[model samples]
Target: MAVASNYLLDTGPLSILCSFPLNASPYIYAILQYTKITLADSVIIEAGRGKIWRIVSPLFKTGEIESTTTPKEPEILDLSYGNDLGLGERSTIKSAMQMGLTAIIDDRDAFVVANRFAVHPIGFQDWMVMLSREVNLPTKMAIEIVRSSANQFPKMFLAHILKLLSE
Candidate 1:
């Protein structure tokens, strides 16, 4: 079966790249190459001038990162009200819904909202699984990447990833 052709990443994934010393996640890079990865202008702004931007801007220049405007749905904003949803997350999800693409968000509330809209929401572990299938990334390397990104990732989430890799 072919993988889905669309993916929308929230700031979490970008933050991971910035916090980790390793290069971009191979799985995410593969998805970008094989699928249409959409980014709201807000997300790009959130990913300001940093190491992540330094690496990602080239991809944008090369047409890998596509910029999009926010959606005009009132309901989408209503969904985000409870959580302290930032502009980037709100805009990213709005764009994903507008384009009928999957939203890759690690935030629980965002995932819930995405699900309500019938938009697929994938988390970090899901991406890791995809990467493991697409490339021969050793479990050790994956663990190291997660460990290095500890500051950006929640301890529970990091422990969960490590446990998954161990198994």
Candidate 2:
């Protein structure tokens, strides 16, 4: 497996990115590696419908995001604990681990599993921070939108980042 110095997006983050309609934008560009974000093959197929496809399909044609499949070799990252993760999440994490890449996933169970293996997991809240702070989005709006969406993400995690963003 090739080492991915890019953020590997999972289905959840991809969906939320598509769904978040901010200023007539899909809001996916806030991801720092937006130009380099990739989707596992399964995730691409999974996200190949609805709002996500509309936003990301053009990017695929423009070569902004890449589509990759699970490697046959270099099957790293023990999957025993990732049973709760869906196929896309599992492959995303596994692929990230093998390639030493950070995974952009939003599932709580997947986060816990990624933590056990020391793989960097960037969830929705983290994306907000990246948007407001790193990506230089409107901090106030990013915080409000992200904080209010706590029900869709991890509340505590969202609170932590919001606090940090406020500081």
- Report the number of the highest-TM-score candidate: 2
TM-score of 1: 0.72
Query: Best candidate, lDDT-wise?
Result: 2
**lDDT per prediction?**
0.69, 0.71
CA error at residue 19 for candidate 1, angstroms: 3.3
lDDT of 1 by residue, 1-167 (tens): 34445567898876674455545444345444345566788888987887667767878888877778876785647555636777787877778878877677988887777677677778855666555455545566666666765566567777667777777
Off by over 4 Å in 2: 1-5, 30-35, 73-83
What lDDT tens digits, residue by residue, belong to model 2 across residues 30-148?
54242358788878777767778878888888887777877643334434643556778777877787777778888878877777767789876776676556556567777766754
Instruction: Please report, as a residue range, the 10-residue window in candidate 2 with the lowest summed lDDT.
Output: 73-82
Candidate 1 global lDDT: 0.69
What does candidate 1 score in Cα RMSD to the true structure?
Answer: 4.0
